[model samples]
Target: MSLKVEFDEPKCVAAGQCVMVAPDLFDQRDEDGVAIVLDDSPSPDQYDEAREAAAVCPAAAIRLVEG
Candidate 1:
């Protein structure tokens, strides 16, 4: 009924798009150029946008866990 997201830091390449797409769900640390999850549970309305963000990630660091 919902979605889950997890990021592998070792695979992250500091592309801040995910944060840009969903500020409520993610944050980018400009100092280190890495994304940090701000909230694990994004609203259902945001699922599509979040999935798109994951798809566009240059490093392919985002994982979509179907619920």
Candidate 2:
């Protein structure tokens, strides 16, 4: 199993929810606090965390694609 994480910068609201939920996969920029994807493809074990991060995003900026 493989998981892919996608971050929509323009849709992000700097909420930091994704970072909080999955720090290993998501981060926030220091300048404007925009969300950034640290790891687009995370290990299978991290799939749950990735999904939680996407679900917690208030702006719906995080997307998780399973393959």
The model with the greatest TM-score is 2
- lDDT tens digits, residues 1-67, model 1? 8888888778888878887787777888878989987766667998987798788888888888888
The list of candidate 2 runs beyond 4 A from truth reads none
Q: Model 1 lDDT vs. the true structure? A: 0.82
Q: What Cα-based lDDT does every candidate model obtain?
A: 0.82, 0.89
Worst 10 residues of 1 by lDDT: 34-43
Among these predictions, the greatest lDDT belongs to 2
Clash pairs, candidate 1, are none
Tens digit of per-residue lDDT, candidate 2, span 1-67:
7788888889999989989988998889999999899999998888898999999999998888888
Stretch of 10 with least lDDT, candidate 2? 1-10
